[model samples]
Structure formats: C-alpha cells, structure tokens
Target: MSKTITLLGSTGSIGTQSLDVIRAQGYRVHGLAANSRVEMLAQQVQEFQPDWVAVVDEAAADKMESLLAGMPSPPRLLRGPEGLIELARHPVDAVLNAVVGIAGLGATLAAIESHNDVALANKESLVTGGHLVTEAVRRNGVHLLPVDSEHSAIFQCLQDAHSAKTLTKILLTASGGPFFGMKREQLAGKTRADALKHPNWNMGAKITIDSASLMNKGLELIEAVWLFGLPPEKIQIVVQRQSIIHSMVQFSDNSVLAQLGVPDMRIPIQYALTWPERVPGPAPELDFTTLKQLTFDVADEETFRCLAACKKAIAKGGLAPCAANGANEEAVRLFLEDKIGFLDIGRLVEAVVDSESFGGTYTLPDVYECDRMARSFVLAHI
Candidate 1:
C-alpha cells in the first residue's frame, strides 16, 4: 500500500531528498509547501502532482499561481502560514516537516492535532515548543518520528531496548562542522564562506552557519531532551570527525549501541517515512573494506559557548530555549548577511538567553511570544 504524506518545505535539502525517497518507495505526496521557492515548487508539483500546494510568501504564491496557470489540472494553491497549517490538516497518513526554524512549529502542531504522525526535521519545533508538541503527541496518540540523522540513529538504537530506565546516557555525535578544533582567536577572522563549508553534510545556509557555531548541536541537545524524555546531563556530545557513527546510547549495564552509516540524509528521511519496516533506497551502502577510521572526542563547551548557553536554557526550562532559538535564528541571519562576525552569533544568542526570565508553565501563545521577544531583543542589540 502506498502511504500518503504531506511534505512541508518541499524545496529544501531534506525536502528534495525526501522527494527522491518518495519516488523510489512509491509513497504518495498529497500536498507540498515551500517558503518562497516557487520555481522549484512548480517543478515538484509537475512531477509529483500533489492535491494542493502552499507558498508561505504571498508574492511568491502569486508567482506560483502564474507559473501553474498553464496546467490543465492545476492543484489547489494556498498562501502564507495559514496555508501551511491547512495543508497539515489535510487527510494524510503522515506529515514530513522539513521547514527550518520556528516557522515550522505551527504546522507540526497542526499535523499532530489532526491525528497525523509527524516526521520532524525542524529542531526548533522541539527546542522552542517541546512541551506543547510532546503533549500533543501523547494526547493525539501519534508518532513523532525524527528525521535528523543523529536522532534517527538514537531512535533506531532504542528499538526493543531495555526501556528508558535502563538507558543511562546518550552519546550524541557531531561532525564538528567546518570549524572543528579551532580556538576563539582562530575563528574571529572567519568569513561566512569559511563557516558554510560543512565537512560532512550538505545543508542550507542557516543550518550550515548553525553547524559552524555548534548551535545546531546545541539546539539538537535541547531537542533530544524532549524527544527521548532525557535530562541535559544524561546526553553527552562527542566530536566525531569521521561522521560515520551518527550517535550512540549507553545502557545501565554498561552496554553501548551505536548506529553507523555513510553521511547521507536520505537514509534517515527514508527511515522516518517507512519506519519499523526498512526498505532500501538510493543512499549508498557502507563498505567496511574501504572504511579507515572513526574517531571521537569531547566537545569543548568553553570554546563553543552556544552549547553551554543551550544547557543553561534547558536547565532553566520554560521559554529560555525558545529565546535561545529566536536569538540564534536572528544572529545566524545577521551573520549570513555579513552584518555580524562568526563569533558574534554565539555571543548574541547567549545574551538573549541570559536576559530572558525562565521557569514557568507556558502555552503555545507564550512560546510564540518568547520567540518574538527574543528576536526583538537581538534586532535591538544588533
């Protein structure tokens, strides 16, 4: 049976690779959405023939409509964030949210609220609104499958394991980005181009910058807490330069299970879509004969303040994580635009996290408010 899915962020790195998986596995793409990439979205619509499509940028939606006008059987077109939520509510077995940052949070909640399982790639969804998302997952009885490589590896390792009680620690692995092993002085003069060069994975500009600053790993740390119901203390990040060992989990009996594979997003993307029933896709198989070495080291939190800041926010609870995410998002944006230096990203995020008050039970509106407030603070400071 072909599983129907609604894919958000259909033009991104994960989204395009997911389309490749869909084509290979014969999954039905019922709807697709993108931020402002109408050209690519049009190509996707033509190829996949979805029931509906959404463009979050209103002007781009107009352009998309114009581009699709020639099609004899044009699918329904929706505009803006409401369109994304509407697309999420559409009847489907699952919703794959690959949208970057907090913009994807609402669609994630909408999908779960509609009783649809979610394949989550957007870390901010959990980092900023974990309480709400986890509650919805429990209330709606839906699976919130992880699409990120590290989380997917951990998820796979935990299958049929000795339960959460037996799990002692999660060894989260980082590629260390392109700036691994560099000191604060070494990174001060780094350019945006230098930071964008990820040693392992091909990702978007925002994520690449986050990876450079180790903020992506930091955000993932907070995300892991909600996804696995673990405390920040139990999760330890290991700087794995090879990028082969995605992540590992240690049991109370001192047994450690790890997931190893080639650096490929399609592997996890396919896993999240097919789940519990693995099917081979286009990703290359690992050849042990040619493999050389896999190395690991502890991450230096002093050098990368983002990781420390993330720990602080996770410990404080409430809206601190949301504030960190918002500030980081803005900081990354500023860095990408050459408005701020590479080191300034972490400094700005830490400042915002420190300034925000913590410890409170929050609603969905509070989450968004915190996000807005953080961004406002970053903008004012910058």
Candidate 2:
C-alpha cells in the first residue's frame, strides 16, 4: 500500500529533501504548501502532481496560478493561512510540516485534530505550543513524529525502552554551528555571511542564523521537553563538534545509547515519514575506516546566552518560550537585513523574555497573541 502525504513547506531544505524521500520510497503526494517560493512549489506540483496545492503568500499564489495555467492539469490552488490550514485538514496518511517558524503551529494542530499523523520538523510547533500540541495528540490519538535530527535520534533510542521511567537523561548533541568555541566579542563583529556558513548542515537562512547564535539548540531543548514529556533539567545539551553523534539517551541503569550517522537531514526525514519501520535511505553509511575522533565539550552557556535564556524560558513556563521564539525570529530577520549585530540576537531575545508577561494556561489564540506581543516588542526596540 502506498502512503499519501501532504507536505507543508515543500520548497524548504527539509521539504525538498522530503520530496527526495517520497520519490525514493514511492509515496504519493496528496498536497503541498509553501510561503513565497511559488516557483519551486510549482515545479514540485508539476513533478508530484499533487491533488491540491497552497501558497501562503497571496501574491505568490496569484503568480503560481498563472505559471500553472496552461498545464493539462494543475493542482487546485489555495491561498493564505486558511489555505494552509485547509491543506492540513485534507485527508492524508501523514502531514510533513517542514515549515520554519511559529507559523507551523496551526497546521500541526489542524493535522492532529483531523486525525492525521504529523511528521513534524517545525520546532515552533512544540517550542511555542507544546502543551496544546501534546493535548491534541492525546485527544486525537495521532502520532507526532519528530523530524529534527537530534529529537529523532532520541526517539529512535527510546523505541525499545520498557518505560519512560527507565530513561535517566537525554544528551542532546549540537554541532555548535559555525562558531562553536567563539567568545561573545568575537561574534559581535561577525557578518551574516559568516554566520550562515554552518560547519555541518545545510539549512534555511533563519535556522542557520539561529544555529550560529546557538539558539537553535536552545529551541531544541524546549522542544525535547515537550516531545518526550521530560522536565527541562532532564535534558543536557552537549557540544559535539563532529555532528556524527546526533543525540544520546542515558538509561537509569547507567547504560547510554547513542544514534550515530552522517549529518544528513533526509535520514531523519525518511524515518519520520516511515516510522516503526526502517527503509533504505540515500544518506551514506558511517565508515569506521575513515572516521576520526568524536569529541564532546560542555556548551558555553556564558558566551551563547540564548542557551541559558531557553532554559530559563522553560522554567518560567506559559508564554515565555513563545515570547523567546517570537523575539528571536524578529531579531534574526533584523540581523539578516543588516540592522543588528550578531550578539544582539541573544540580547534581544533575553530582553523580550525578561519583560514580557503572558504566563499561565494558554489557548491557541493566546499563543498567537504572545507571539505578536514578543514580535512587537522586538520590532519597536530594534
């Protein structure tokens, strides 16, 4: 039987790689959605011949329709967030949400509520709306698979565990981006070009920036707490310069299991799409002959303040993570636009997390409101 999937952010790094997985595994593409990259999305639609397509950018949707106008058969096109949500609600075996930011939260909830298992690569789905998403998973009885490499490794390591109580800690690994051991002063003068050069992974601009600031790992920490139902303290971020050891989990019995592999996004993407069953993947196998030493170091929380900020956010609970995420997004956008320094990313996030106060039980709307408040604060201050 062929599995049908709706791929959100079909033009992104994970999205494009997911298309490769779909092509390799012979899965059917039921629907596709993207933000402003209509050209790439149109190309995917042409090749995959999905039943439906959505472009979140209205202008891009208009252009996409024009681009596909003369085709013998074009997928039905929808526009805006409503279109993305509608695409999520479309009946499919799974929804691969590779969307980059908090914008992914809605489609995640929508897919789960509609009884579709979600292959989630969007960290914001859990970072900002962890409680909401977990509740929906329980209520709808759907699988929320992790697509990020670190979380997927931890998920894979825990598959045979008898119970959650048997796991003592999750050792989340980070490649430390392009500036692993750099001090704050060194990063202060770094350019966007310098920050975007990730040492291990090829990723989107926003995520690359987050990785440079170590905020990506911080966000992942919060995400792990939600995805595994573990407390913040139970997760330890280890700086693994090699990127080979994706992540590790320590058992209560003192044995640690680590998932090792090449630094490839498609591996985890494929795993998330085809859970409980491992299939042949396009990523290369780890060769012991050519492999060198795998070193681990303590994450420099003092230099990369965003890591500490995220730990604080998790402790504060409520809208703190949401605020931190929103502020970081805005700060990264500014940094990319040449408006802020590299170090200012953490400064702005810390400021927003400290000043904002949207704590307590939250609804979907409340999450959005907190996101708006944090963005507004960052934009005004910047």
Candidate 3:
C-alpha cells in the first residue's frame, strides 16, 4: 500500500532529494508547494501528477500555471501562503515540510491541526513556534517526526524505550562547516561562494550560509530542545569533520549509542517518511571497511558567536529564540548579497539577541511580531 504525501518546498535541496525517495517508494503525492522556482515546480508537477500545486509567489504562480497548461489532468493550483496552508491541510498520510526559514511554521501547524503526521525538515518551524506545534501535536494525537540529520540521529537512538528512560545528554554532531578552525579575523572577507562550499553536504544557499556560520547548528540545538524535551545545555555540539556519526545519546550509566551514516539528506528524509518501519530505499548502506578514523573536536562558542547567542536566547525562553533566528536569517541574507561582511553575521545576530529582554509566553502573533522586530533590528543595525 502506497502512502499519500504532501510535500512543501518542492524545489529545494532537501525537497528534490525527498522526491527521489517518494518516487522510489511509489508513494502518491497529493500536493506540492514551492515559494518560487517555477520551472522546477512545473517539472515536479509533470512527473508526480499531484492532486494540487501551490506557488507562494504570485508571478511564479502565473509562470507555473502557464507551464502546466496542457497536462492531461493538471492539478489544481493554489496561490500565496494561504495556498500553502490549504495545500498542507489536504489530509495526506504525511506532510514532509522541507520549506525553509520561519515561513514553514504556519504550514507545519496547519498540517498538525488537520490531524496529519509531519516529517519536519524545517527546523525553523520549531525554532520559531515549538510551543504551539507541540501543543497541536499533543492535542490532535499526531506524530511530529524529525527530519534533520542530527535530530533524526537522536530520534533513532531514543527508539529503545527501556534505555531511552536513562538518556542524559544529546551529543549532537556537526560537520563544522567550511570554516571550521578559522578565527574571526580570517572569516571577515569571505564571499558567498566561500560560505556555500560545505565540506560534506550540498544544500540550498541559505542553509549553506547558515552552515558556514554554525547558525544552522544553533537552530538545530533549539529544535532538539523542543523535539526531545532537553535543555540547550544538555545538547553538546561536537565537530565531527567526517560527517559520519550523525549524533549520539548518553545514558545514566555512562553508556553511549551513536547513529552513523553517510552524508545524505535522503537517508533522514526517507526515515522520516517511513518511520518506526525501516525500508530499503534510495540511500545506500554505509561501508565501514573503507571508512577511516572518525575524529571529534569541541565547538568553540567563543569563536562562533551565533552558537553562543542561541544558548542565551533559548535560556531566556519565549521570543528570544525566535528573535535570534530572525536576526540570523536577515543577516545571512545580507551576507549572501555581499551587503555585509562574513564576521558581521555573528556580530549582528548577537547584538539582536542582547538588544532586549525577550522573555514571555507568546502567541502566533507574538512570534511573527518578534520575527519582524528582529529583522528590522538587523536591517537598522546593518
């Protein structure tokens, strides 16, 4: 029996790889959505023949509509964020949210409210609105599966219900990005191409830049908190250059279990889609025979100010993390466009985190307002 799935961010790095898994498994795609990338979205609609498609950008929606003019039975087209929300509520077997940034938060909540299981690739969804998402999941009795490599590794290790009770800490691993051992001075003049050259993974430009700054890891730390009910301090970031050991968990008796795999997004993506029931699919088995020694190093929060800022934000609770994330997103966007220097990314994010006492119980409106304020702060400061 094939499962019906709705895929958001259908033209991104993770989104494209997710399609590979969906195709291999013969699952039905009920709906597909993307912010732009009209040509790619058109190609996907042609291949998958989905029941509905959404283009968040109206101009791109027109392009998508023009591209799909003569299909045998083209899917219904939905436009803008409401289109994304409506497409997410299609009640599929699973909603794979690969949408990037804070934009994915509403769609994630919509999917859960519609009583659909979510395989979350969008870390910002939890980073910005973890409380609301978890509440919706608990209220509706749905599973909120993690799809990020590090969180997925932690999730896989925690599957043993007996030993899981004794879990003490999450040894979250990091690839250390392209600028691992460099000091702040060395990164001051790096370009977008320099940042996008991830040592182990091929990702979208935004995430590639985030990986360069270690902000991606910072966001993951926050996401891990919401997903595993662990504090930010309980999660330790280890720089594993090989990108092999996805992550590890420690038990009370000083025992540790780690999940190891090749650096492939599809592995975690496929796992999220068919969780609790492992199936042989697109990703290949890791070959340890040719594998070299795995190395580990301590993360320097002093050097990666973004990581340090995230610790403070999550500790203060409430809208702080949302603000931190918003600031980083804007800072990264500016850095990518060469409007700001590389080191300025960290400087801007930390300043925004320190600008206010962002502590309070927040509603959805509060989250968006904090996000807006953070972005404005970054814009004003930069």
Candidate 4:
C-alpha cells in the first residue's frame, strides 16, 4: 500500500520537504527531476533510490551521472526539459511538480496525459495553462492536488459536506510580504537583499522576492480561480502577516471557514500527498498557547500594482495570464539580479501585460508563444 511519488525539482524547497514527508510516511520515490544542483540531486538519489532521475542541467547531469557511477544501482539519468517531461510520463502513481517557473507547465501536462495524479506546487503551470491543465484533468480523470499552502487550505476547506452551490466565496490569505504597509515612495529604494527577507515563511530567493512585492499572492489569486473553479470577483485577498491562517471560504449562509497552521510548507505538502487519509508526520503542529493574536487587513493595491494587474489578467483570461506569468518571471529575475528595483518589477510586469493582446482560446502553442513574446517584451523594456 506504499505510494510511489515522482518528485520534479527534487532539490528545491517544496521537493525537499516532500521527500521528508515521503520518508516519514514510508512512501516510495519513483522518479526525481531537477534543474542544475547535481550535488544535491546526487545526494537525494543516494537516499531515495528512485527508478529514474532527470537533470535539466546538461553539465550538471554529466556530473550527477558520474557521481552515481559507484552506486549499487543508480537511476537512469535523463537530461534537459525534455527529460523532465519524460520523467513526468514515467509509470508513477503521483508526481510532485515543484519546478519553479513556466518550465513546469510541460511536465504538468505530461503527468496529466499519462494519468498520473499531480501534487502541484508549480503555480505557473496553472497560471499559464489553467484551461489546458483543468481540461486534461477532467478528460484523463486524474487527481490534481494543490501543493501550495493557499490552494491546499482551500482544498481542505472544501472537504466539508457543503456543496459548491452553498459556497459563496473564497478568502485567499496573504502574508503581505515584507513590504506590507510600505507606500510606493517608501519602497522605491529597497535593495534585492531587503526584498528577499520574508517575515512569515522561508522560501527560495525568487519566490521570496515575489512574496515581497505581493506578486506571489497575485499569482496565487489567478491560481485559486482555476483550482477552485471560482469567479475572480468571488475570490478575496486578505493580508494576514502572520502566515498562520492559510486561507478561508465564506458560504452563502454568511459563515466563514478557514485553515490555520504554522508557516511550514510540510503541512500542505503532506496533506496533498496523503490526501483523504491524513497520515501522521513530524511536521510542526501549530501551538495556540504561545500564539499571539492574528490580524487581517486589505492589501494596498496602489502600492502592490501586481495584485491589481493579476485581477486584470483573470478578467481578460486566455493568454493574458500566461503573458503575466512570463512577464513576471523575467521581471522577478531582473529584480533578483539587481538589474531592476523591486518596484520596477511590478512596473515591468504591468507594462508587458498591458502591451500584450488578449488572444483567442489557448492552445499549448498559444501559451508558450505568448510566454516567449512577453519575456522578449519585458527584457527589451527593462
């Protein structure tokens, strides 16, 4: 009865924590994929001993394969994005896709088409290809579990016997990033180091920077619309700096339900993997005794223009979200590289999104094309 899980981006924050969950629950690691970080991937392979391993970094793959030469039995190594896509289609029961950017979309589709249940931490997959991912899940009749904390909390809240008809709205929570109450003028001179310091959660540099600008929350907003099948208007963003209350749902009866926990990623990651059957884990349980009061406020859309632009993208639909994801990825990279200010990240995203035309219905080609176009546009503008 052991679950076999394929972990994409196995060296990352979510992927590493998922490995912890698998280790704790005695699940099997079927396949592992990562971009670069061969040393870490090699270490993971030594421990997990997956059936297959993929490295998106060609040079790193060479290094990893050499490192595993002495193993009693090493997983067959695959290279590049195509390799990761093939890994997703491997004969595994589930795939934990933790790849960081638009790079995850292909793997996500591959998993779905192969009828592998997906534990999705890659928001860009949903944000860029919401229609395609949702439709494929429906056609293939596979489980698309949300690994992000906000979506996972909403998924948990929906487990209540109440019907979707009884649901009134979804209240998505945000930690308000590092610059929560800071005005535009106050944040203009902030450095990359400043933006990378998140008050609530430990995360990678890119995601931490995204969180600081509230762009992470904005991306999550679009992701929630797709995952929960709720109207963009029906979803509300709450700035909860504590990161305790992950998310909430308000039913038609005016009753509000929420999922509260420590800021640990393991809680949601474990939930997604062992869903419908919560297995016990060593993930830190929230302690109410030492906990302080939880506070909530409306996000400053004026300062956090990315949040507003996300709402616009959702309204526009189709390739708009895809373009937004692409543009945001570039802008975020520039911000982290110190090529642009934190505020300019949002400015660049807004510019790219505005510059792109909202095309007709999305095909996979359309999404990728739009993503490339947006990236090009953002690079030129920045």
Per-residue lDDT tens digits for candidate 1, residues 31-139, read: 9999999999999999999999999999999999998898878899999999999999887988999999999999999999999999999989999999999999999
- RMSD values, in order shown: 0.9, 0.9, 0.8, 1.0
- Stronger candidate by lDDT (1 vs 3): 3
- Model 4: per-residue Cα lDDT at residue 246: 96
Once model 3 is optimally superposed onto the true structure by TM-score, how far is the C-alpha of residue 314 displaced, in angstroms? 0.4
Top lDDT model = 3
Which pairs clash (backbone N, Cα, C closer than 3 Å) in model 2?
Answer: none
Residue 200 C-alpha lDDT in model 3: 96
Which pairs clash inside model 3?
A: none
Clash totals, every prediction = 0, 0, 0, 0
Give per-residue CA lDDT, model 2, range 213-271, as digits (tens). 99999999999999887799989999999899999999888899999999999999999
Off by over 4 Å in 3: none
> Which 10 residues in a row give candidate 1 its minimum summed lDDT?
159-168
Extract clashing residue pairs from model 4: none
Task: Give per-residue CA lDDT, model 3, range 1-382, as digits (tens).
Answer: 5899999999999999999999999999999999989888888998999999999999888888888887779999999999999999889999999999999999999999999999999999999998999899999999999999999999999999998889999999999999999988888789998999999998999999988889999999999999998788889999999999999999999899999999999999999999888998888789999897999998877888999999888898888999999999999989988899888898989998899998878899999999999999999998
- Could you give candidate 4's per-residue lDDT for residues 150-227 as a string of tens digits? 999999988976555588899999999888899999999999889878897889988998898888888999999999
